[model samples]
Target: MFGKTFAGSPRRQRFLGNRREVQPRLEAAKMMDRLTLLPAELLDPKYGVMSSPLLPTLASKFSNLLVDPWESQAALSVLLAYYGLSCVSTIGLRQEPTFGNEKLITTPIAFDFSHNDHRMAQYLMWGHVLKAVDALVDLLQQLDYLGDPALGKMWDRSLIYVATDFGRDKTRPAKAESWGTGHSLNNGTLIVSPLLKGNRVFGGIEPTTCETYGFDGSTGDSTPGLNCSEGHIYSAIAQALDIEFPERIDMSALLA
Candidate 1:
């Protein structure tokens, strides 16, 4: 581990002259609750850029770090998997740590654009989301977690859902260099999982007005004429996982 106990603290310097910190304090805080628990090798981009003699050592140390209880164990578990290490302990459990059987793990990525400055930096925000998801997909593929090979299945039940607070306004400045958008009623969620009925979008977007329309979940047909609620989205996810809920939703179109 990086040898710190709290978040937001500077990582231990790796080299004498390389004063440039490897990880940003803010970004590190967002990823791990305890910055000190991170392995020093990860802080140096060079470790991952090229084969190093220290990879085994770094991986071993990282595996040890996962043994301790932490707030961001779910994220750490993914990180460990990225490094081809096993996360034996329960994620986010502090006391009486034991092997976990949890099939679902959730982590927060700070993609909110509440500040005005973020309005002009949409690309950066999107880039972060893309990079994070790409890394996860790559790791999952490497681990062969996409499907059960024994069953001849193409996909596993694992899923990643990216939900946002709200949607941006349809309107934009006609000729402004830096335009800002406002919060709107419309928004969409991104669901990534091989178990899903892929390559299909349930909602319809109006070209002239840039508005989103509802869809029929049962038939995967555009239902612009009907209105849907947030509960419908929740129901779709539940249906995909084969979990029973009291809420009624026609998620037949959204599930596999």
Candidate 2:
């Protein structure tokens, strides 16, 4: 949840020759417009801005001011560009007919489960998370949740999940530009979401993946890799949203 996200202006350089203070002052003024623009009664600033009656209060009113209107109509262009690079492929899974009406209201999103190359040239950790968020947000908005209050209410119940294989390397990768940034089975998984249930982190990552536990039961084949994280995360999300997982699964052990 970012307050105000601004992409740089393309024509900003043309104004570079102007007073150095002009640009910063203008930007600040625009931001102020956005902040004071919210249609709500302002609470005492002491109580905090969020306490105000602003609709969609969590979203920034200034978000619209981002991006150069001449170059692009999109907000957060720079952040989105950074996001575009780290992402490899986005595979959206339509609700399978096999699930029938059981999945009538739910959508499944599965990303590339392949291990991220630690040696890659550029990788933005937050970018990966944002991509997933963008996808989920797109799915929700497409379903018309943004327009329908009831639909949006139901979406408030939905959960967003982030499942990764082990933890980031404590040392950073060993090769040239690699940095010792490899995998670390040392810490636990990080699960972040605005959904209430997603607030808690889970599991324990030991030196051996074998010791890291995710599921509730002893599924003999459960291995502490990306598979395990995905399974548990899915199960928790399914439980949260009152959706059922597909039966006869390869990842059932992880969901146990």
- Each prediction's TM-score versus the true structure: 0.53, 0.32
The regions of model 1 sitting more than 4 angstroms off are: 1-37, 40-74, 77-120, 144-155, 172-180
Number of the predicted model whose TM-score against the real structure is largest: 1
Total residue pair clashes for candidate 2: 6
| Cα-based lDDT for every prediction | 0.53, 0.37
Let me know the TM-score candidate 2 reaches against the reference structure.
Answer: 0.32
Q: List candidate 2 segments past 4 Å from native.
A: 1-155, 163-179, 183-198, 205-227, 248-256
lDDT tens string, model 1, 1-256? 5444533444433542244553564344343432234545446664333332223433443332343233234345554443334423233222222332442111123334345345333554565445555554544554443223553321254566766667878865778776667788687777887768877777788876687888878887887756567888888878887878777686877766
Per residue, candidate 2 scores C-alpha lDDT tens digits across 24-77 of 765654433333323445545563343212224223422222221211111222
Query: Where is model 2 poorest over a 10-residue stretch in terms of lDDT?
Result: 66-75
**lDDT assessment of candidate 1:** 0.53
What is the clash count for each candidate, in the order shown? Answer: 5, 6
lDDT of 1 at 100: 27
Which residue pairs overlap in candidate 1's backbone? Answer: 2-38, 4-36, 146-156, 217-253, 218-253
